[model samples]
Target: MTRTESLANRLQEVLLNGRWIANTNYKHQLEDITWEQAIKKVGSLNTIAALTYHVNYYLAGILNVFRGGELEIRDRYSFDLPPICSKEDWDNLVDEFLTNSEAFVLEVSKLPDHKLDMPFVDEKYGTYLRNLEGVIEHCYYHLGQISFLKKLIFA
Candidate 1:
């Protein structure tokens, strides 16, 4: 497979599903989570819902880059998660996250290998591959947080 295709497959495995990695995908990790459980905070820690939004915030920003826009997100505003006060609200958030993730993966898959090495928007931001891989790494890091928070809330 091409490098871009490989990256896309890896992104898909990490987000939607995974075969080689077993039960570590985002969808698998989020399975059966309830709004009440997601919004619970443990000792000043972030809620699962908040972390979910935080991760998606960057993904959405990267999506903009793929769609010919500059990176526009700031870390200070990353944690401004919306209220997940109802199951419908939480469900919609998940739906939006998943849909955007799918689209991001698709857009990245369309990139030629040469574009991967080019700077993402500007030289200061690093290459497209760097940012893309960074997004995946960022998701897994927060996914772990969400997993731990769920244990605290649901266990």
Candidate 2:
């Protein structure tokens, strides 16, 4: 498969439905979690709701650039999730994440293989491949945290 297709699939593996990598995807991990459990604090670690919004924040920002918009996401604000006070709030965040995840995957899948080697946004950010891979890696990193937090909160 082309690099773009492969990257898109990897993204799916982490955020949506594939399970070969972490044995769990974001959808599987977040679907059953209630608003209370999502916002539960496990020691000093970030809540699942925060992490979910965090990853989706980047996905959405980067996805904007993919659609010809400028890069506008900042690391400091990645976790600035608004209060999820009810099931509706949590569900809305998950819905946004899922929508952004699907859109991100679609944008990546549509890219030309040659674009993978081209600079993403700017040279300093590295190639499209690098950014795409970074998103996948970043998601997995937080996914691990979310999974661990889930166990801790439930235990």
lDDT of 1 by residue, 15-128 (tens): 888746545777877778988888887999988888889888888988887888877999999999977889999999888889988998899899999999998888998998
lDDT of 1: 0.84
lDDT for predicted candidate 2 compared with the true structure: 0.93
Which stretches of model 1 miss by more than 4 angstroms? none
lDDT of 2 by residue, 111-149 (tens): 999999999888999999998888889999999999999
Q: Give the per-residue Cα lDDT of candidate 1 at 44.
A: 90
For candidate 2, the 10 contiguous residues with the lowest summed lDDT are 146-155
Q: In candidate 1, residue 67 scores what lDDT? A: 89
Worst 10 residues of 1 by lDDT: 19-28
Q: Give the clashing residue pairs of candidate 1, or none.
A: none
Error of 2 at 56 (Å): 0.4
